[model samples]
Target: MSAARPRVLYVTDLAYPARGRRYGDEDVFLTSRLREHFDLALCHPLDATALMDAYDAVVIRNSGPVLGYQKEYDAFRARALGSGARVYNPLSGKADMAGKQYLLDLSAAGFPVIPTVDRAEHLHQLPAAERYVVKPKAGADSLGLRILPADGLAKLAGLADGTVLIQPCVDFAYEVSFYFVDDDFQYALYAPDPERRWELRPYAATAADLEFARHFIDWNGLDHGIQRVDACRAPDGELLLVELEDLNPYLSLDALPEEARDAFVTALTASLSRFVHAAQGTQEARETLIPA
Candidate 1:
């Protein structure tokens, strides 16, 4: 890697045993290609804060769930935000990047998300269901997720604590995901059988499908970085948001056609280059404004 090129600290957890996904292989392929445009160093998420200073930007990719390393993740965010370190995904995310609070916020605003309520007082607002899903607000990759009967859900989450989000389990036709780079659509995938969630295949996204996905992306308002908008088709034939994963969302690139995958990489490289340049310009402007 030449010093003339921007240096990127690419973060991933190669040993993280994520179910139904090969985090290591995907990142290896991506970084190899990205290295052509920028100087790159691979590091585990645990080592990011320590090593980030040497790089022009930190790329968080396939780092697995942060639930296990909450303290470290928190420290990384605090340090990055305060120090103005350029972090891809930028840390201004309102969705899962922050937590499940936005689900309730979106639900309250009626933005096609699964109806989410975090406290006991709001239980009456939820749709009637035999069972409800309860999961941690900080959850990822299904960690700390549970399903409880209607009578038990409120008790399970301890409504007073508000640490968990509750939603009635919906019987959906299929779960579909829309991958995006900034505001641009990259590809879409779906599970034909709801029982086989990870058995994804390429989906022919309709106009409405693209519009549905873009709403959240527009809401997120990130100028750069990759995002995966996960959703499900309801029995009523409407799509509802399941998650807006801005922080280290695993891209199911292996499922895409070779051409599409290559295009995504091209888009990613350009986006990262722009992001790094923008950050550099902003840093320069800030320094110029400082008093001598």
Candidate 2:
């Protein structure tokens, strides 16, 4: 509404020490480029609520795991929703934005996600494997993840209580991620060796590969926002959904070639612009409805 350029409050945790990725480096590079298109200010996740009112939109980049500051994050979410602040991701995401329960929900709905069971009694439905993966329902960044032998399955019955998700440990060949912007496929990257997840290389996605990734994107139903579809290539040569990250997904722009990186930035800039415009229009509509 001001005569100045649209301001964006770029929310990120520049100090977050990720396992194999430099969260700060990527966000720095992104904000530097984004400054060219809009008036931008970088702030820590905890400060977003205090500073967001001055910006046109809040772009959540690598803000680290929300679990670290769940209470503050919840407060920020409530404020953003209540104030109708223009959030880049729009806060409508149902995946990690909410929790890991989507895995069980999708699995039960017959999605191609890895078989996930939240109840202890459902353990019998899982494939018989030597080991199983147990992770907290509210976990992130591999936190509280455990691997137990098949014999430990019964022990998990007492631990389920709907706060944990159980899945058979899959011996996957490799893990790949498909990055998208506003429902459009951007690029694919894969860890050729399962042991090193962050060592990524350009992956040439086949028609079927794109199709598989698109299924989850379509299911998410986000009209505009960035999303990452994480998947692992199973031993049987099928791709299974590992996770659908719609909330502040880290784009490994450093891994992409110069041309691809530029294209992605361009796509992102345009998307942000569209989001700002749409939000402004909606705000104006609401103002017009009120008695002036």
lDDT per residue, candidate 2, 122-228, as tens digits? Answer: 87889999999999999999999999998887787877789999998999999999999999999999999889899999999999999999999998888889999
Clashes of 1: 0
Off by more than 4 A, model 1: 1-3, 151-160, 284-292
The sequence of per-residue lDDT tens digits that candidate 1 reaches over residues 148-227 is 88778547557536888889899999999999998899999999999889899999999999999999999999888999
Which candidate achieves the best TM-score against the true structure?
2
- Best candidate according to lDDT: 2
Q: Model-by-model lDDT, in order?
A: 0.91, 0.92
Q: How many backbone collisions does model 2 have?
A: 0
Model 1's TM-score against the true structure: 0.95
